[model samples]
Target: MNAMRLRALLLASLLALGAFAQAPARGGALPPPLPLFPLDNWWNADITHAPVDPNSAAFITYLGAGRGMHPDFGGDSGDPSAPIYGMPYVIVASSQPLVPVTFDYDDESDYAAPGRTPGYPIPNEAKSQQRWIEGGLAGGDADADGDRHMLIVDRDLRILYELYALHWTGSRWEAGSGAIFPLDSNARRPDGWTSADAAGLAILPGLIRYDEVYGPDPIRHAFRVTVRHTNGYVFPASHRAGNTSGALPMGARLRLKASVDLSRFPEPMRKIFQAMKTYGLLVADNGTDLYVTGTYDTRWDNDVLNPAFGAIKGSDFEVVQLGWQPSRSDNRRRSVRH
Candidate 1:
């Protein structure tokens, strides 16, 4: 073929290929949806878009008449200028990536708590089958904070594994709690039960990723935060009494009050705050008041992220309408996904 004609034909083919590569699904529809849980899980199922809990007003009133809200996330990690700067994030990378691991545990471990195993060179997975070889144990304590939550996602396998207080004693992986979760479900921890996290909730479900801020997708779920006090439990929350108290019970879901103003914040911060307003936060553990959870990424600039929510306060949040589901039977999920 003539050189000019050949060049023109090649250019036309390339243009067509580029458009096809970026095209939407058939009928111009969006891609298939991701599940609501696990590492790949975004906030698509977040309560913000869900119907308002009919009992939100009463729950807020019960928490207190004059209670103020706080932002657990913001400012910089270890920077004085940041409001919630003291908290750190744990970044996963150590050990074998995307592989399950076996560990030795104390009497408190879920495997031991159930009381099924006897002496063994390796503990059995009859009860804890999912724990052995889940995620890579090589995670860093980003904020230098002791929470040491480890999250590993096997993207190829479409699975997410989580652990709390995870540590490698140079021999075996030990942790305060551990859980195996399928990335494809809206499932909560079984009612009146617990997972690797104290709140019986999966840790990855609530954490904010840096990409979520930079990407088109909105964070679709609630943020997991801690508080020193809570009354009882709530629904979507499967467990109760992570050691119980006059304070809140395990699985309590609290949302950012809708009335709060988010207009002044920047785009990224506004997205997060808007999520708080709509989806609110879940009480996953006992800690300082209103500390929300997020992952570690070096790309974050403390200067920008910290000041984004500077004007927000904790009292601005209100308890949303969610009641505790006390029994496994009461909150039994027939399948992983509803």
Candidate 2:
């Protein structure tokens, strides 16, 4: 073949390969038509009309009602090599290999007998790919710190595996804690058990995935949130990581007041705020109050997110009655896109 034609063909092949690598279905973040769990699950419950906690005022005050909401996620830090801030998750097939993870809190983690074998399904590529695990680093990087949460979903098995403070010991995986959940069920962890999250809740369900925020459908589930302090845990939350007096519980729900005006914000931000009004935010962990978590994606522009989220203050939200669940007859939603 002519030299020019050979070069052109090579370029075309590279472009096609890039496109395939980026396809959502191949191994992207969560795919569309979501609510990872069943609609009736607490993550998908419609709490817009749920009664507010009588201590809502106190809770709001404790969380600093004057503070504006913060989007705890965004794109790269100018440098393409930097990891974005947010909890990231991966979708794997049933064939994804199950690797044994040694847990710091072994009693609370899921594992096989004898040697406490690693049974969590993780993609092999996570060994070297950033953004596969939380903190956006490859699983084997020992230098990576922070929560370092790792969430993996076996789509074919409809199961979720989440690890907290996850790290690779060069020889094996070690974590602070880990939990597995059947996506199709509403099962809760054993009482007082701490999962990958302090609340013993599924992290993916509560994350504000990029696709769901920008997709055609409205967000249908509660977003995960963090608070500076928590007193205990409520129903949906099976574990307690804090005991600060007068603070909100781990499972506390904070709903954006219907009175909050979302019209002034851009469409995407407005939709997020609207979901806050509808499903509310689930306090899944202890961190900065009103900091909402989402997926790590380069598409996210912090410049747009920062000021937009800052517009809504803590005062605009009210704490829903703790442990409140919608009526069984209330079939009001679908799966969480995360």
Candidate 3:
């Protein structure tokens, strides 16, 4: 390689090492600036910037923030009806075994423009959910169409799998759409490519998780939020708003208040609260205001986190990067061509 390239790599290596050495001992550690899917691809490269439009004031006026951040995943597995709002995710460790699984897709499939044939192998097993599926009917959003979601995180593969309109036929997995994303890569669906998610975005990357909370790592990217209405969308968003009466759009981004103090919470919970200030949250789907989605794990103590969220309300959030660019603003085909 050229001398300049080699020098840049060396400099980056030193900086990373320096940051590692300086990690604070008392509180949760800071996450690396760039996150990769498995080991090399950048996952959250686009979300780290501050909001472009600074429309938090307008958003607060229209779509209220509702309540402080709440933990959707946690606690003993006994509670049948908890983690209210929308769908949750499933986490699988790298060491866990991969099983013979299948994926079924329809109109929403990113694999196909008109949507390709279904019945692709996903390699999942029953043990996969200890988190299980969120049984019962799916919510009535046009995008979700009563199809409950199945979002999986394979920590070992560092790969993320998302399936929509999912239903288990007693023996295997069945869903409307499916997309696999490598956590290491910065790649997104081709401009307007739709994934299993309503926004055509990968679900796992935008979720809240127990490990990211309790461990030294902070959530690097924004968490996916559901809202009742929207005005338009922003770049990196592959779909248009299903409804336009609201103030915010499909891809509108929201950042947590930098002034919101996190020092009072426990170390684990502190990382999540701090993420709100740093990574912020993204508007992904339709649901209750400020409801951030996450994976299902018994370790999460929703009761413990419910009260801590009282500190901040919807007014504390800012709408970063408003969905402008005349072509993308209107509800036409979600592409630059208009």
Worst 10-residue lDDT window for candidate 1 reads 23-32
- TM-score, per-candidate, Cα-based: 0.61, 0.88, 0.66
Ranking by TM-score: 2, 3, 1
lDDT of 1 by residue, 200-296 (tens): 6777657665667766766555677877665555655555544443455656666666787788877888888877875567777777665666644
Predictions in order: lDDT: 0.50, 0.83, 0.56
Off by over 4 Å in 1: 1-145, 241-246, 324-338
55: Cα error in model 1, Å: 8.2
> What TM-score would you give candidate 2 relative to the actual structure?
0.88
Residue-level lDDT for 29 in candidate 2: 46
Best by TM-score: 2
Q: Order the candidates by lDDT, highest first — what do you get?
A: 2, 3, 1
Per-model clash counts, in order, read 32, 8, 22
Local accuracy of candidate 2 as per-residue lDDT tens digits, 161-261 = 88898877677878899998877788888999999999989898898877777878888889999999999999799999899999999999999999998
RMSD of each: 11.0, 4.9, 12.9
